[model samples]
Target: MDYNKVKEGISLLLEGLGVDCNDPHFKESPERVARAWTDELCIGLKEETFHLTTFPMTSGDQPNMIILQHIPVKSICAHHLLPFIGEATVAYIPQKSLCGLSKLSRVVDFFARRPQVQEHLTSDIAQYFQHKLNPQGVGVIIKASHLCMEMRGVKHSGLMTTSALLGCFLKNSTVRAEFMALARLQ
Candidate 1:
């Protein structure tokens, strides 16, 4: 993250908008906003934050769907740079391995900290587990309230939902339905 560059850019932006950057209330705003963006909003762009660990499943264990729901997500909108706050529901049917339950939340946060569209965010997370864990199936759903929509344009406030299904979740109706039921998307 280029902290200095972001701070300078923000200061110049404020100046260009006729906001006095030297005023006491606004003096440190540029630095603060830059830090907030780098540390909180766009942290997921860093590759180091995406490590997910998986454990081998026993041969005799039944292949089953695992669902993790309502994992909190806060992401910046790629179009507006404003925040979209949401919850993600991720489900996977293990092929030969399973990850820690908490790892699902970490995965959600890792992808959420980047500037993204809800649709892309949904697919990214689903594909990630599908590739890394080689799950039999993966499903991801996100429901968000975008600040750009709530605070700009028509100023309407409503949740936007997006979902992605892969592997068995995409090919098998029964498997997809079970995941949706567990996620309360039915």
Candidate 2:
């Protein structure tokens, strides 16, 4: 990432808005904002895709639904360039492999670090697991408060929910219901 260019752009933006960077309080603001964006906010732009570690399922291991609930979801909105903060629930029914538990949360963080819409984030996470594990089903749910909606558009604040379901999560009602129950969306 060209940190200097980002800093320059930020400075230009501030100056365009009539804020002088020479002002003591705002002197370091451009660099600070650039660092915030590069080092933290948009890390998905820099990091490689999360490597999901998998192990074969044993005959004795039951093929049951595995769920990780309330994993932190943080992302910048694609349209407004603001942030959406929430938690995500990722669940899947194993076919023959199990993903490393921590990798599930990593998946959420991996996809959520980019500028994205909640619906796309949910679907992408589900697709990653479904493609990686070849799971019998994958379901993802995100409940978030978008700063775009809450702070700007209508000035309302509430968690907006979105979901993506695949495989049996879409084809089987019983499976879907159980997954939804786990997400508290039933």
Candidate 3:
């Protein structure tokens, strides 16, 4: 929200890194990075962007499992301020209501845009739909490769997987199994 402050801070960071801001190529770099962070990476911090509209189920509507898979996950690692890229699978069983199909992916993007650890991001998205929809259950699974780990210490190239299950998804083995199967998890 404070564009000027962010620009100033990024300028200071460039200076601390011994980069000359006066250089032709670097002159606008601070403003550009600051704007990119606010407009892209930190967009989720704004509450207005999280509005999820739901539709009521009719008598003809049957309660069933709904799964959205291969939803892209792009987030910054909170610890090292690096990037993590992956996909997420979100599933839930209806309980008298259903949200738009695209809303599931929007929810994922909402949390992903914030600087966060994969674990918390998984849990937050699960909790959001669980609380908002009061569904029979909610399940979330994420698989991502973090730049922090890949580009630094140990330099190991490995994917990290995390999952969160709530309500029936947590209590019922069959339900959990089905979700994981649909998500293509081993």
Candidate 4:
């Protein structure tokens, strides 16, 4: 990300909005926004360096779902560039391999760092696992509160959006139910 470019854009945006950029309080706002974007909102770009380690399968040849729930996600909406914050529940039934628990979070962050719609984000994670692990099943669910909706437009409070992708999880009702049940619990 080009910090200078973003700073310039923000400066112009503030000027367009008729905000006094010369004011002491507003003078550094552009730089600060650029810094915040690089540090917090856009940090997922760093995930390209993430590497998953190989580990022995512990499921003893029985395909079992590993569900990680409530993984916190904070992202910017592509349409409005406003914040979208929420939880992601991910599950995969290993075929012959499994990733470390923490690596799953890294995978989530890898995709979350980019500007996205919730539907695509959910599907992307599921597809990543499907391609990488070729797992027996992969399920992903994302529930988020979009600041664009809450802080603008309709301005409705407590509005939440959800999206999901169920792969092999879709073929078996019992597995799908179990995944949903796990996501709902606690």
Candidate 5:
């Protein structure tokens, strides 16, 4: 993305919102926001590579669920241009392939950097694993706080939104329940 152009746009937007650009506190806000977008808030732009490998089945040929829980997620809502901060829980039953434990978190980070809806984001991660890993099943759940809702619109600060994608998880009640139970664990 064009960082300079974005910085300029933020400056213009702040000016339009009647924020004093010359004020000491506000003068550097635009640039700082732009840097945050390019670095932290939008780091998914750099995650274009998906490294996959085939590993020998070490789980004794039993298709056990692999769950990664409470992965911190932060993204911008496409509709409101506001922050959506949350935690994601993902699970998949490997068929004959498996990915590194950390790779799952990287995949989550990859999609979270873009502006998106929570529903779409949840489904995208599940779909990616299903398609790429060809797993027996994939599940994704996200619970997030949208700044758009908390700061404006209804202004309900305590409201949290949840979205989930259940592929094989839905077809099998036991698997679905297990995934949910693992996700809720502290």
Candidate 6:
């Protein structure tokens, strides 16, 4: 992230908006915004920010549906560059391996930290597991309330829901039903 560029741009923006850049309260605002935006936009894009680990499924272990719900997500909407805060429910059936339980939440956070649309974010989370673990099926659902929608035009509170179903979750009704049933338990 180019902190200096962002700082300069913010100063220019404030000046254009007729906000006094020399005001005491506004003096460090540019630097503060730039520093805060670094975590919101840049940190998650790094490859090492979150490392996923999977455990091999044993011979006797059953390939059951594993669902983690209420995983909090905070993200910047690509369209408006505003915030959307929500919870996600992720479910997967392991064919050969299982990801750590806590990593499920981490995965949601990992993807949500970037500027995104809820649809693509849902698909990305499911696809990442599909690519990495080669799971039997993956299902991801996110429910978010976008600040852009409420704080801008329309100015009404609403929750946006999006989901991505892959493999068996896409091909089999039974698996999809089971995942939804468990995931909606909250």
The per-model lDDT (C-alpha) reads: 0.90, 0.91, 0.93, 0.82, 0.84, 0.88
Candidate 2 stretches with Cα past 4 Å from truth are 1-4
**Cα error, candidate 4, residue 54 (Å):** 3.3
Q: Highest TM-score, which number? A: 3
* Model 3 lDDT, residue 165, Cα: 99
**Per-residue lDDT of candidate 5, residues 1-186 (tens digit):** 789998999999999999998999998999998899887887777667756555667757778999998798989999999989988888898888888888888888889998888888888888888888888899888888899999999988763646454567879888888888888798
- Order candidates by lDDT, high to low: 3, 2, 1, 6, 5, 4
* Residue-wise C-alpha lDDT for candidate 6, range 1-186, written one tens digit per residue: 566887788778888999886899888877877777775665576556456899999999899998999999899998998999999999899999999989888888888887879999999999999988899999999999999999999999999999999999999999999988887787
- Ten-residue region with minimum lDDT total, candidate 1: 43-52
Which residue pairs in candidate 1 collide? none
Please report the TM-score between candidate 2 and the true structure. 0.93
Per-residue alpha-carbon lDDT of candidate 3 for residues 1-186, written as tens digits (9 for 90 to 100): 677898999999999999999999999999899989889888888756467799999999888899999899999999999999999999999897899999999999999997989999999999999999989999999999999999998789899999999999999999998998889943
Each prediction's TM-score versus the true structure: 0.94, 0.93, 0.95, 0.89, 0.86, 0.93
Q: For candidate 3, give the lDDT of residue 60.
A: 92
Model 3: residue 125 alpha-carbon error in angstroms = 0.2
Clashing pairs counted in every model: 0, 0, 0, 0, 0, 0
User: How well is each residue in 73-186 modelled by candidate 1, as lDDT tens digits?
Assistant: 999899998999989999999999999999999999998888889999999999999999999999999999999999999899999999999999999999988888899953
Stretches off by above 4 angstroms in model 3 are: none
- The ten-residue window of minimal lDDT in model 3 covers 43-52
Query: Could you tell me how far off, in angstroms, the CA of residue 181 lies in candidate 1 after the best superposition?
Result: 1.3
Largest lDDT belongs to which candidate?
3
How many angstroms is residue 66 displaced in model 6 relative to the true structure, after the best TM-score fit? 0.3
